[model samples]
Target chain A: MIRIANGQGFWGDSVDAPGRLVEEGPLDYLTLDYLAEVTMSIMQKLRRRDPAAGYATDFVDLVKTLLPRLVEKNIRVVANAGGVNPQSCRAALRAVARAAGFGGLKIGVVSGDDIFDRLGEILDAGCPLANMEDGRPLSEVSERVLSANVYLSSYPIAEALAGGAQIVLTGRSTDPGLVLGPMIHEFGWERQDWDRLAGGTVAGHIVECGAQCSGGNFTRWWEVEGWDHLGYPVVEADPDGSFIVTKHEGTGGMVTEETIAEQLVYEMGNPRRYVTPDVVADFTSVHLERCGPDRVRVSGARGAPPTDTYKVSISYLDGFKAVGQVTIAGPHAIAKARVCAEALWGRLRRAGFTYQETLTELVGLDSCHGTIPQPPSHLNEVVLRVGVKDRDRAKVDRFGKEIAPLVTSGPPGVTGFAGGRPKATEVVSFWPALIPKELVRTTVTVEKAAG
Target chain B: MRRVPLSRIAHARSGDKGTGSNVGLIAADDRGYEILLARATAEKVKAHFGGIVRGVVERYEAPNLRALNFILHDSLGGGGSASLRTDAQGKTHALALLMMEIEIPDDYQTPYPEGSPSKGPPAEGLSAPRRKSR
Candidate 1:
């Protein structure tokens, strides 16, 4: 059996979690998932500004905090903190390790997931890279493409582990692939071990959100015992293709079957077929039971081979947008908020700037659900959140300047406008497309850096 | 039949993928699951979301877990980073769908005997994550 813990859920997740995870208990592998679909474009912009700024620098800090324990406990790390640039991330970590006087650590860099440079060549080969939803081809928006990366599988990562890499860093690898790769290397599971691969994938999903499986954001928030002290999730994997999801015993959070079940459905599309880079997991075949306190025994996951294509996340320059909000209070707060929203837009229209899309919502009443839910007739206060998106950045900037004027110009109850003005920011739009698996080649290179 | 909010019998979690959003709803019991499969069709969900969702709604059943997954395409204006809305990542979409009222048998009650926490707390503090949405 092997123990794997997911400490960092996202890039800006609570700091000290990863170091505390290694310091708290015995752990074999520490996996951190830092990339989302649109993260590539942001990282691309950062890379353009500064050559070494693409990766999540927060990850480097976390590694520095845990450097002593990681070497002492022989705990390995697998993280997709590379973002758009894996080599620079690895080089940065190497510098950190070298400065700390640990020269025996080996960092395995898994790159080639980034296909931005080769997108044109691939397109010329007759693949349109059509948008999965709109059916429009990528060629329509190729001129604006900023970043295009193929979602990598576990094979290259597994190879890195087999080559004795103490830490693995990847770019654009699937979240579950981080766990599955280490499992394949340790258990020596074959590529055709579909059930085992599926089991690992399910285990990864359980703990991918950190505390989500360990009592945070649960449906029954009241029933959770420790609200202040929450434990992150850890997976205990057996060679027989089953895993037990649990947290450290004295930790803050509870890990019952119900808690784990809640995370299983989070952000899920088709329950029966959860597609990862490695295999297509059948989540319907999953079986969960409460083995003990803060422990959920998970088994019976089935799977099949993956599809012939890899889903590529292609981001482009969509436009610019700016959002501003003002608190409207008193007897007719909702009505006053509505007036403020219209007045802001009316002012923008009169300024000869028509936006591609404009959104206006009352924060307290209909912001969350839009028109789906009905609010009460009277409300004490409402925040008028208004925003506009347009191809022209100047137009969005003009809309931003109009929000604060409501305090003196339009609504009687408008008062709480604090921020100077919401500046127009570039929109890094996501375009999901598929690519033939054979078109992209994944490579892993391991280099020793720290002791 | 009697009218009741869908939250009386189900729990939901919503998230986004590109321009699409998915709301996963799990029933309290098998009886509630049966009610959902019978009433919460794709058409009903699409209609419930109305203009907020620009595309079609697709439903997938997970019988073992007593859950239904609804994928609403073109739900966000574009998606994270690209959408101008406050809830760009579609974080509170579950609460939106919970407001949907459904008709159920008058005699059939929820499995829970006491207070209904499943009704969900009011939607508060919806913000898009700058670094990551998942």
Candidate 2:
């Protein structure tokens, strides 16, 4: 059995997790997933400002901290920290490794998932790159597209591992691909090994969110212990496509059939068909059993061939938006908050400024669930949040200016407006499309740290 | 028949998918699973959410895990960064769903008994503790 553990759930996850995962247990491979749907667009914006600033900078510091332990323990690292630019990330890692005196460190770089430059060529070749949600053609938002990347399979990651790199960095790969890649490399699983691929993919999904599968977000929060030092999830995967989901000994968090069940259905669409680039896993067929303390054995995961097309994540600057909030205190807080919101909108309209979309929420009351039955008759305070979105940046900016004036002009008890006027920020919206699998190609290269 | 909140028999977790949200409701036991399968229909769930959800609701069964997955379409204002609502990702939708009340047989036994710590005091205006059959 190979021991693989996930440390970082997302880009802004716990900073101490990666090092703690290495120090706490026996791990053969460590995987970190950093990319989310909108992350690539942010990276693209960063790259446009400074050529070498696109990738996850936190990853470089993390590797610097864990490099010694990783080399001593012979642990291989796989991560999608190379957001939009793996070459620059590789260079940064090479510099860090060399400075840290691990000159012989081999880092693999995976590219070709990014198709931003080739969008016109591909679209001209008959692939419309239409939006999957509304079936809108790309021509509607072509000029505003910020980042375009295909969700690559685990094959390139596995190839990098086989090339003898201690660390593999990729761009726009699936979250499960980071874990499944090591399984493919260590067990030598072929591309068509549907059952085994499905098994690894299932394991990947469980631990990808760090402690969410363990105890961090369990529904029975009262039953879980050791919140200060919760153990992240680890997988003891076998070649037969079955795995054990457990954490380190004497660590916090409980891993039972129920916790595993909750995580199994997290962010899930269809239980019968969990689609990834490698295989379409049948989540409904998965069997979970409490084999031991804090250990759940998962088996019977079935799979079928993947689709002919690969889903592409594209982000564009939809518009500009600004949100501002103020606190209303004293009795009748909810009523006063509503009045404040109305007066702000009323002032904006009188100034000859109207936005494309506007939202007003009394955050403390029914903002979340939308007017649940029998709300409390009285409250001490309520936060009045107002926002506006528009194609014209000036209109959104004007809406932001209207929020702070409510502190002195609008209501009796308005405060908490110390932050001043909210600035209009670009709204980077997600656009999911599909491209034929054959149209995308991936390349992997291994480079040694320059001493 | 007696009505109790679904939280007494099941637990849930939810997350967003573009403009929609997926809630995974898992029963506490085999009997609870049957209760959910019978009472937590897609139509009922849609009605329970009321104006909170704008589009259709679809439910899928996962018998292996004693769980039912419900997908609420067009629920978020726009979802992700595009959404203007406070709960852009629908993280609290699971607890909102657990607030739903379902009718059970008068003689039925629950894993979380009445007055237990897990089953907190009944919400205001609920019928006082009594056993009856419809």
Highest lDDT: give the candidate number.
2
- Candidate lDDT scores, in order, read 0.85, 0.90
Model 1 stretches with alpha carbons more than 4 Å out: B104-109, B113-134
**Please, what are the lDDT tens digits per residue for candidate 2 over residues A1-451?**
9999999999999898788889998899999999988889999999999989889999999999999999999999999999998899999999999999999999999999999999999999899999999999998999999999999999899999999999999999999889999999889998788989999999999999999999977876767989988999999999988999999998899999988899899999999999999999999888999999999999999999999989999999999988889999987898899899888888888988888899988887888877655676676789998888889998888787788788889778999996779999999898899999988988999988974
Q: Which of the numbered candidates is closest to the native, going by highest DockQ?
A: 2
**DockQ metric for all predictions:** 0.45, 0.52
Per-model TM against the reference:
0.94, 0.96
lDDT of 1: 0.85
* TM-score, chain B, predicted structure 1: 0.82
